[model samples]
Target: MAIATFGLTNIHRRVDITEGGVLGMVLLLDHHFGIPPWALTTVLDAACYLLGWKVLGRDFLIRSGVATLCGAIFFRLWDATGPLLPNLSAQPLLAALLGGAFVGVGVGMVVRQGGSSGGDDALALVIAQKTGWRLSRAYLFTDLTVLGLSLTYIAPLRIVWSLVTVTVSSLLIDFVKTVGHSENRQKA
Candidate 1:
C-alpha cells in the first residue's frame, strides 16, 4: 500500500503525501538534503525495528521484520514496473483518495495482525503504550508534525492536499483497528 501510494503520488504529479512515519521523514530528507529516500527509509526503519524489539517485545519485532521485508520488496517491484502502469496524473484528487485508502488498509492489516510495517507504526505503538493514547491519535500527531515541517519545502496548496490524504488514511486505519479489536473482543 505504501508503494501504491508512492506510485500514485508520482503519477499524479502531486507532492508525495505519506502517512507520517520514517517514510515521511525520508522524503523530507530527500527533498532537503538530497539523500535517497529508499536508503534513508531502510536505515530509519531498521532503527525503529530495533526500538520495537526493546519496547514492543520479540514477537512484535519478528512480525515487524516480516512486514518491513514485504514492504521493501513491494517498493522495489513497483519502482521497476512503474513505466508500464496506467497514468492517473489527470485526476490528482482521485489518485490521492485511492492512494490513501491503499495505505490505510495495508498498514492497518499489518498492525491488526500484531505486526507493523515499521517506522510510524512502531513509533505510534510506543507512544500509545507510554501515553495511554489511541494508536490513531499518536499516528495523527506524528503525521501532522511531519506535514507541518514539510511546509518548508512543499507548496501550501499541495500541503493541504497532503493533509487531506493523511487525514483520510488515519481515519481508515483507526476504523480498521477498531473493527478488528471489536471482533476479537466478541470472540473472547
Candidate 2:
C-alpha cells in the first residue's frame, strides 16, 4: 500500500506501533498543530508504570515498559521520516490503514502480555476488572472514544482509518494469544 502511494514500504512498518510509538505517531501526525504529545505520553507512561508495579507485577510491567519504549522510539523515527514521505492527502486511506494497524498491534501485544500501552488502555483494564466486562469489549469502548477525539485534529476519514487499523491490530493480537494458549493446553 505504501509502495504504491509513496514508494515507501518500510516507513511505518518497521516502527512496531507500540503505545509509545503510537504516542510518537500522534505527535508526529499532529506536530503541525503544536499538540502536547509528550504531556500525554508522560501521563500515560506514568499510568502504565504504576499499573505495572502495582496491578500487573514486575515481570509484566517490564514487558509493557519494553513495548512502550519501543513504540515511543519508533514513533520518533517515523516522525523524523515524515518529511520524506508524502503528506496524508497523498494517500490518506493507506496512511490511516497502516497507521491504525501499526498502533493496534502494539496495543494488543502489550495487553496480551499482561500489560498496557497507557492512558485509556490502562483505564480500560481497570474498568474491565471492576465491572467484569471482557477486555476486548473494554478496548473497543476506549478506542471509540479515542477515535472521536482524533477527529478534532485529523480528517473524519482519517479517524475512521485509525479505527480500522486499531481494530485489525487488536484482533490479530488476540488471535495469536488465543492460539498460543490453546496450543499450550493441548500440550499439557
Candidate 3:
C-alpha cells in the first residue's frame, strides 16, 4: 500500500516530498550510473515502509499502503493519457491551474486516509515525530521548497503553474481531512 502512495500525492495538497528527495537523490544516482533506478527506489521505499510500520504503526501502514497503490495506479493512467492532452505551455496559467488542481485533489484523498503517498511524506512523519510539528505545515514547507527548487530547471511561469497546482492540491488534502474523513466515518 505504501508502495502505491509513492506514485500519487503532491505538495499543493499539503503532502510534500522533501525527504523523499533524499531518497530520490539515490534513485537519481542510480539513473545517472545506469543502474535500475526503480530497483533502488523500491528498496528504499520498502525500508521506509518498515520504519513506518515499526514506528508509526498499523494505521499508518494501512494508510500508506492504500495511498501508494492509488497513487501508482492513478499516475500510470494520467501518464498514459498525457499524449492526448494539448500543450499547456500555450497558456501556462490555465495549465498550471488545471494540473495542480487535479493533482491536489488526488493527493488530498491519499492524505485524508492517513497514508502518505511517498517521499517527503516519510520525512514529514519524521519531522512530526522528532519535533512535534504539525504534519500539514511541515508538508507545505517541504513542498514549497521543492517547487522553488523546481524553478531552477523549469521556467518561472511554469513554476507559477506548479504553485497553483500545489495550492489546489493542498486545499484538496485539507478538504479530505475536514469533509471526506468525517463522511467516511459516518458511513462506517
Candidate 4:
C-alpha cells in the first residue's frame, strides 16, 4: 500500500491527476485549505484507528496499527529513494494502470491478513461488516464519494482517469481477496 501510494503520488504529480481514497481527500485538503497531506492523513487515520478499535476489536486495531506503521515507513523510504527509481509517469495511462494494480494488491494483502493500511480500508471493512456488502462494493461507494468531492478541485479529464484507476483497483482488490479466500479454504 505504501509503495502504491508513492506510485499514485508520482502519477498525480506528473499528470496533474488526483487519487480517489483518503489520499485524494488529503490532496484536496492540501490544495484547497493549505493543509499538509501527512498531517491530515495522520490525524484522520488515527481517528479511523480509534473507530476500528471500538468497532472491530483489539485484534483489528493491533494489526492495523502494524500495517499502518509499515506503510508509513515504506512511504518515507520510497520518497527518499525517489531519484533512484525510473520515471514511470512518462506514460500516464500505463502509470495509472500499474499504480492501481499495486494499490489493489497491497491493500488486498493487508485486508486478507486481517489488517488495514489506512482509513479507507478500515471504512470498507466496517461497511462490509455492517451492511453485508462485499468489500469491493464498500470501497467503490466510499471511493466514488471522495472522487466526486474531488471534482470541485480536479479537472474533468483528470477525474475521468482517476475513476479508471479507482475502478481497476477496486476490481483487482476483490479478485485478490477472493483468490486468497479460496486458497485458505483449500488449505483448511
How well is each residue in 119-158 modelled by candidate 3, as lDDT tens digits?
5566556555666555555556655776665554455664
Ranking by TM-score: 4, 1, 3, 2
In lDDT terms, how accurate is model 4? Answer: 0.75
lDDT-best of 3 and 4: 4
Name every residue pair that clashes in candidate 1. Answer: none
- lDDT string for model 2 (1-188, tens) is 12211222232433322222235345544555666876656765576567546765677667666665665565566456655644444564566566555445555556766766555456656655656655555566666665666555556654555566556655554443445663223210
- Residue 158 shift from truth in candidate 3, angstroms: 3.0
lDDT at 154, model 1: 77
Give residue 118's lDDT in candidate 2 (0 to 100). Answer: 56
* Candidate 3 error regions (>4 Å): 1-40, 43-51, 78-87, 125-135, 180-188
Which ranges in model 1 have alpha carbons more than 4 Å from their true place?
1-15, 35-39, 77-86, 180-188
**How high is the CA lDDT of each candidate model?**
0.71, 0.52, 0.54, 0.75
Give the residue spans of candidate 4 off by over 4 A.
1-6, 9-16, 83-86, 180-188
TM-score quality measure for candidate 4: 0.83
User: How do the predictions measure up, each by TM-score?
Assistant: 0.80, 0.59, 0.61, 0.83
What is the lDDT for 57 in model 1? Answer: 97
Candidate 4 local Cα displacement, residue 62, angstroms: 0.8
Per-residue lDDT of 137 in model 4? 80
lDDT tens digits, residues 104-160, model 4?
Answer: 888787888788888888877787777777777878898899889988877787787
Best by TM-score: 4
